[model samples]
Target chain A: MLDHNAAAARIFTAALIVIGDEILSGRTHDKNIAQVATWLQVQGIRLKEVRVVADEEPAIVEAVNTLRARNDYLFTTGGIGPTHDDITVDAIAAALGVGVEVHPAARAILEDYYATRGGLTEARLRMARVPAGADLIPNRFTGAPGIRWGNIYIMAGVPSITAGMLEALTGTLEGGAPLLSETIGCWVGESEVADLLRQTEKTHEGCQIGSYPFWREGRTGANFVIRSVDPDRLAACCAALAAGLTAGGRTPVAGGL
Target chain B: MLDHNAAAARIFTAALIVIGDEILSGRTHDKNIAQVATWLQVQGIRLKEVRVVADEEPAIVEAVNTLRARNDYLFTTGGIGPTHDDITVDAIAAALGVGVEVHPAARAILEDYYATRGGLTEARLRMARVPAGADLIPNRFTGAPGIRWGNIYIMAGVPSITAGMLEALTGTLEGGAPLLSETIGCWVGESEVADLLRQTEKTHEGCQIGSYPFWREGRTGANFVIRSVDPDRLAACCAALAAGLTAGGRTPVAGGL
Candidate 1:
């Protein structure tokens, strides 16, 4: 079992398992990684790692057991629909050493939803099947609820539905202080400011600076993102970086280029 | 050691490690995952898994060692630049029990490329560092060349730069038959045709069918993606699916909606 109640000042981390073959085959561009990462940050939790796996039972089971064991929480998106490829619930159940069972509330919700559209079919009821002893995360968009078994959150592969599940999950999990960031963009090559960045990050004990270089308008530029759990330290690090860029005769853009 | 001389008819798989704090922070939506996935598909190499980790040494080292050991090929993008956060070279070296060294050829290439553009400062020279006993993957976008050691390919984080490196290394690696896919769109909910999809896929032998549901124009619809390595099997599966959709009183779109 994970020691979730370790210390108040400890960092809270979550890992995501993206279950789908479409993503691996390059048929779909995944928006859930960024969506979940951003949402976790706002909830004061850090998204430490993400694994994109194919829609296979062993693959999903391995990823679920591996990530859920290491992180504070595990969130999965995809493979929960009514199709044959939708096997996340079953895979996760096997990983947790549990049997698959239909959640009463979820079945009732699907029945009510399909009452007017069409009578509930066995295929539609597949959406209600969850790992034994699992709760439901309400979905406002579709009647199919997301599954919540232990720390594992099984969300929909669709971006909009995932967004609704995230909205419903806001402020529900315990987390540390939110990681704050300040981005400073400059129309200068990153190599020109690498030393300054290293120095600034070293000066701020709790801060980290990331340099992302890009070529735009036929000129080399980069956006340096400084992050820290402390707001005062984040601000100081950003100011130092801005000063360094100015000292090097480059005007820094506030947000990004 | 991984057996590179596997049976010719066997599937060749590769894993990708995307190392960056920007991606984990949700500040940057990753483009390299799709780019590499598409490129690897064209090369007839199936992408088995992808792990996105932060710009930390232990994280990079763990991902590198784990993925490199399991897959036929392991590729990494990001943290290969001149910034302080760029620690891919050192971390990979640590993982392989190798030492970091400045490759003379890489140094010469950087000297030539940076002669007119700022004359190769110390910070820019950092790009020349590589894991010892590693070959270079040519980069036409910038002076910094990608690294190739054993079956691991260390690529640039920038999508364009990574594309250039991938283009340079094209046709150099051996792989099996490329995976083929066909998409059929229908204006019907996936649950309505789930049984047909499951039966069709089971009957098709090697084909796997994925159903992606969407809502547009205030109407429910779905796109069924059928994939197989054998062209005949893929075509047969798509034809069967289209026929089934038509039999169920739905028009199937050939290339998806």
Candidate 2:
């Protein structure tokens, strides 16, 4: 496991390669992008880009190669299954310039899975093949473990399993302090948050303050949101926002949040 | 608007450029990617890529340039609202190498909207500024219309409205026959699908047949999905799958699909 606490200050970037035809066909809603984006952000890593490609080998290989080369980390979800459409291994193998081999670690895991689950056949063993010189990101959900090698993390496309595997692998990553955010809702519209939003940013340098206009109960209002990695600075900004809101006569409660 | 029929036969490609901090923060689940993917798929246009980016101008600018340059069509959603986080217009301007101007046609629509909504301030008018030389994609939800310039089609991130706008814009683009697909479920495990899946693909030279392993109701099975632009070819693959399943002692239903 990597020391996540020590790597806080450095920049981390990731790219998601969503490989599937169902997603492109609009039959399947990708439940991964936003989830991955947020997880990376809170971990102090930036999800720099995402690419959704069809199951085509060339497209997948090209995407994996391009993104893996450019970003600090590449987390790919989808295309790791037992079916014939499951070609992420081939694509990744191509991307890394390596041959696909049944990884011993993954093979042991699959054997255990077959012992427990029963009826898992050699076709299921296809999931055991990992590119040369790769380790596994333990799949807590099923037998098919994901691979992590050279900044590329290949996981499953299934939403529940993808999230769980990512969470399990969280400790392996070096992360900065999780970003903290606070929000204050007001009857004020964007126009009202405009001045405060600008002032808030100026007063709290290094923090991001944004005005969000929303409609609720037939009334137009705005939510002022503040985000920063610095905890003390975050609290100070909240205090200033509460004071400003109260001074502006908006009955600021505990949440200038 | 461009002629829809003219755009139908051409193989149009799209890239989704999502701009929002909420998405990156996981504060919100982005509903735009799947919607656009489905819309483009049904239109005979392929949604080739998707990128969910922060509201940062540079990120949006970079994604716009990349997606637009590579694909035949590019669709962007979010960040074109009436608040501080809404920086899509300026980014699109930067992407297109043009100045940000209040598109007269779009501004007229906004004026009419404010006349009724009663909270239309100058800040609200910010939604009216589009990249110079862009045309508007009509908004069915709110009056703030999405815009189109060059190869990019920009729309709101909100699902209902984004979908409505996409539906309205469908007739304008040229594309191939929407990729047709046939899906059949079986109780046989994914291993069973492997041989049949390969055979189906081998038989249908131009079609893509994907076998997906799914576990549900204490039974592990695979869904045979055959996709192609030609309807006859897709049907033939499905027929072969059914025949193969029946030969293997599993009575496959011809069509519950």
TM-score of the second chain in each model?
Answer: 0.96, 0.91
Clash pairs detected, candidate 1: none
Q: Score the docking of each candidate (DockQ).
A: 0.82, 0.58
| Candidate 2, pairs of clashing residues | A183-A257, B4-B171, B7-B173, B7-B174, B7-B175, B8-B174, B8-B175, B9-B175
Interface RMSD of each: 0.7, 2.2
lDDT by residue for model 1 (A67-163), tens: 9999999999999999888999999999999999999999999999999988899999999999999999999888999999999899999999999
Chain B, model 2, TM-score against the native?
0.91
TM-score of candidate 2 on Cα atoms, chains taken together = 0.90
Real contacts recovered, all predictions: 0.82, 0.61
Best by TM-score: 1
What are the runs in model 1 whose C-alpha is more than 4 Å off? A1-8, B1-8
Candidate 1: deviation at residue A216, Å? 0.6
Compared with the true structure, what per-residue lDDT tens digits does model 2 show for residues B82-187?
Answer: 7666789999899788999988888888888778666557777888898999898998767889899988898987677788789879878877768788788777
lDDT of model 2 at residue B84?
A: 65
